[model samples]
Target: MTEPTSRSAPADQTQKEGSVVMQLMKHGKEVGVPSNELSSANAAADQKGQPTLEIRKDYMYRSTGRPEKTDMIKSLLTDQDASRNCELYLSASSNCSAVESSEDSEEDMYRDAEEIEREKILLCETSSSEHKVSVAPETDIMEYCRKEWRGSTPVAIRMRKGYEAVAQKFASIRRVRGDNYCALRATLFQALSQTTQLPSWLRSEDFTMLPENLLSKYDWIKQWQLKHRLGRKMGEISDEIKEYLMLLRKKWKNISEIKGPVEKQEACDKLFKNEEEEYSLYEALKFLMLNTAIELYNDDKDGRRVPVFSWLLFARDTSSNPCQLMHNHLNHIGHSGGLEQVEMFLLAYALQHTIQVYRLYKYSTDEFITLYPNDPEEDWPVVTLITEDDRHYNIPVRMCQETVL
Candidate 1:
């Protein structure tokens, strides 16, 4: 990380010009770098004796005695509350030796904000147009159930009725791996199946060329580049998110372009089963979830009222400072443990889509189907999933299955 620049004048003659020169800062005082060696920029309002702001070439900040300038500059560039929270997060991350040590592994890389900015994928020029839903073609429900259970237990036989019941209303079950990341995987599967333009919804205005008011209500992006600075490595966090989004868009388009359902499934299998693809998606999901939590926490803290995301705050050992809890969440990425209901709700909101989960229990009530966010602001695309135990999720592909009258 480059040292922060200083704000001192060489002489009264230079000071009268209202220009600020960059100087090496150390221990709260300017030193070392010669004034002539540093670059100079004239302040717009120098004649009025107002300090001109100079944008830092990079986002790294060092802990120093002079915090007021840093605070002021960040306040101008980002949401005030989010900026403060991100500072604590970055500070904590910079000191975590474990995080810094994981730079060698491809799965545990951390990226700098400047790097992300440089490689940022421009939104497709035609992305502004409406996206069509590339619905996953239906498959045989009984065949899917048989393949899933493999005649392993008597309970599996009884569950067939519930699967049939689901089949009556839907087309087929798009199976998801029964892992800790099932919910996220299931959601992404259904979401991507719906459209190849998922990036249009997921990319933050801060990171992409998006309109400010576009989906502003559900937009969870806020100083995310800073919040997601998990490691101190130069380029450890190589934009897994950008890579993941581009690949998904490509894969969805590839699947949609296919002529047959079987061929489409084969294409999906190729992408979904790839260990590298799964890891990239998981990392991207973790990054999005972590930053979303920070945005919500900052909102709640700023409002000082009944917490909107109180469900997420409770049920966890916060240890007082919520930021520490967030830090713990960041550390747990790529580790064991499934995402919680609050997180699913957050993901649903983040995607601006409704997640409908259907229970595959032998006996269930009207609550067999549940919707995240209860009420949505728009007619967002619906992503359907089926869960036998509710702990894991699988996409339910709708198709033209003939119903037995």
Candidate 2:
């Protein structure tokens, strides 16, 4: 034994080998592996006397420990400064594969274009009320120009024309009622009467009775006709016929009263049960009577004046004071200047009898007081005054006389 070749040499060599294995184990742990598993696997490989070169299976070590080995390999392959220097090579290979696939797909480009064009034509030919027409994506200006030139009407324009025609027809139907023309004339007469401060005599009596034809001939009628044409179109009336009939019947009933006051009052109650509704009838009757009275009062053509007093007496058959009735009629005329004189005359006549009675009473009482004031035992002589020839006369004797005071 060449001095037994120092047993330390083999021991040192074993230690060096173990250190290299530890270094590999440390590297595996650093790259995310269990340190104990890495060490045990390396020790087992060493015990089998396997070539350390075969034991250093980097791929095996990486795959055995990692769930994301493929991802790690991809990352490593993409890195520019990677020790393997395979990033550029892998990138070139992937690029070439993509280019080949693109070329293969390009072979059907013309066919796809033809299919798209067919679809567009099919869509354009189809007409549907439910589905709205829409412009094609990426449409060229020339395509829009061609479509516009074809006179394919827009939905909005067609709808507008249809509505306009309907409106014209509706307007034509409104004229048949004759209310518009009549209302305008009524309004004009009312406005003029109010503004001029003229007596109601100037206004028409029973103005509602004015003929529609007569009202239609007014100047304002022409103005309204120019502004808006009347009447609705044909065929639209049937839908509204029931309502129109009801309105016509109502108007007819109002115009035709064939009943006495009791029957009329009952009818009025049936139609208008509320007191507020009666106000309209009251106002209408008041206007009618006022107009009639004014016309009769102002009429200069007749030689004989219509005595409103006679009318009042006719209305009230019982004994009514003529003076009071005349005064009321003057009040109704509502001319202050003329009313004052009538009022004064009525006032003078009202006090005349009372003044005479008071004067007679005072004279008789004074004479009696002068004759018998101091004598308590003597009975006073009674005095009586009688109206004869518009003068008061005193009676010296008081025999069963009754004084009406």
Candidate 3:
């Protein structure tokens, strides 16, 4: 027979086909298919002039026993160029998959972090809303005392007896709400009560007490009114302070003019019970204290003496500078509950009244009374303050015909 006419693809087509074969062999090796089987598939495809894809599928599904086909496969595996190209292709593909997976992981991490931040913000807001201080109402001292005495101990018996004696002295016991402002509130309440009892003649600016004024009032008001003057002279007092003083004067006049004892009491209760007016009065009292402190500082400087204010200031903090101390104590929002014994003395001198504090202990009712001025002459028009704990003050209504200041 005539030599079978050799048939082959064009050189270019043959090169492309070779490349495809090489790729198939590389893929088969990666997927754990035997090299001999891949070689068999390729050689069989060449012999039959069949498609590479059909041969590969056939070889993959059905194992090959053709030993003669292995030479081409061994040659392809040993070829350095083919091995390098296959490795490079596989490495590039693996890198692309790794990059995409890393990007996806990075995205997941960011999403988790953002979710955590949102939770933190929500938690802080919830905490702030929960901790806000609620308004406290004034309550009876006996109710508190009853709770105290209910405990059947020796201390309880002593406390019960002491409070009973106090209760008999006063018609009623009204506790000032315990806060930084308690002492000031109790003192002001007593002052206002005393102010209400004063005759319009004595309340006037004339600084003169008539025979009629004297007849109407106790000897104490005569002295208290005569001594009472503005914390600073007229020129030195600021307009803002003037307004506060005038407002207080107006409150005194309005309360004094009220018809009956019950109505007057209601008016006073309403003023203190309302938070708005209560804080306004606190502002006034604080400003007054600051003003007094400033005047005292200036006077001390002029006299060329070591200031008592400086001593108190240095004792409390580093700076003995009056202005620095005043700014720190008065202007700071967080500096609540700083009104000390010295400041109480300042308030007493500023208001021109004696702040008499009668302290009751947990164990005993033995009165620990303190007067701000500590004058030998126990002054009338005194603000009678009672405290169970020395920190907070309350008003005890005196039983006598004399109105409690």
Q: Which candidate is the best by lDDT?
A: 3
lDDT of all predictions: 0.43, 0.24, 0.45
Model 2, which residues run further than 4 Å from truth?
1-206, 209-266, 300-302, 308-405
Identify the superior model by TM-score, candidate 1 or candidate 2: 1
* Candidate 1 Cα lDDT to native: 0.43
**What TM-score would every model get versus the actual structure?**
0.50, 0.16, 0.49
lDDT of 3 by residue, 172-279 (tens): 676565545677788888777656454332255621222223224323212211111346453322334445545665676788778776677768877776665566
- How well does candidate 2 score on lDDT at residue 374? 15
Residue 45 Cα positional deviation in candidate 2, in Å, after optimal superposition: 99
Question: Mind giving the per-residue lDDT tens digits that candidate 1 earns over 1-405?
Answer: 111112222333332221111111111010111111112221112111122222221222234211111221211223323322212111111112222222212111223343333323322322343112122235577777754544423445546767877777776665555545677777876665555343444433343212122124334332223223345443322343445545544565566667675665566666666666655666566555544454555544453221122322322333123344444444443343455444556676556677877766423554456566444334577777887754567776655563221
> Model 2 misses residue 281 by how many Å?
0.9
Task: After superposing candidate 1 on the true structure, give the runs of residues whose Cα lies further than 4 Å from its correct spot.
Answer: 1-139, 143-161, 196-199, 203-205, 208-234, 238-267, 304-315, 318-334, 400-405
Q: What RMSD does each model have against the real structure? A: 22.4, 57.7, 41.4
In candidate 2, residue 23 scores what lDDT?
24
What local lDDT does model 2 show for residue 274?
A: 32
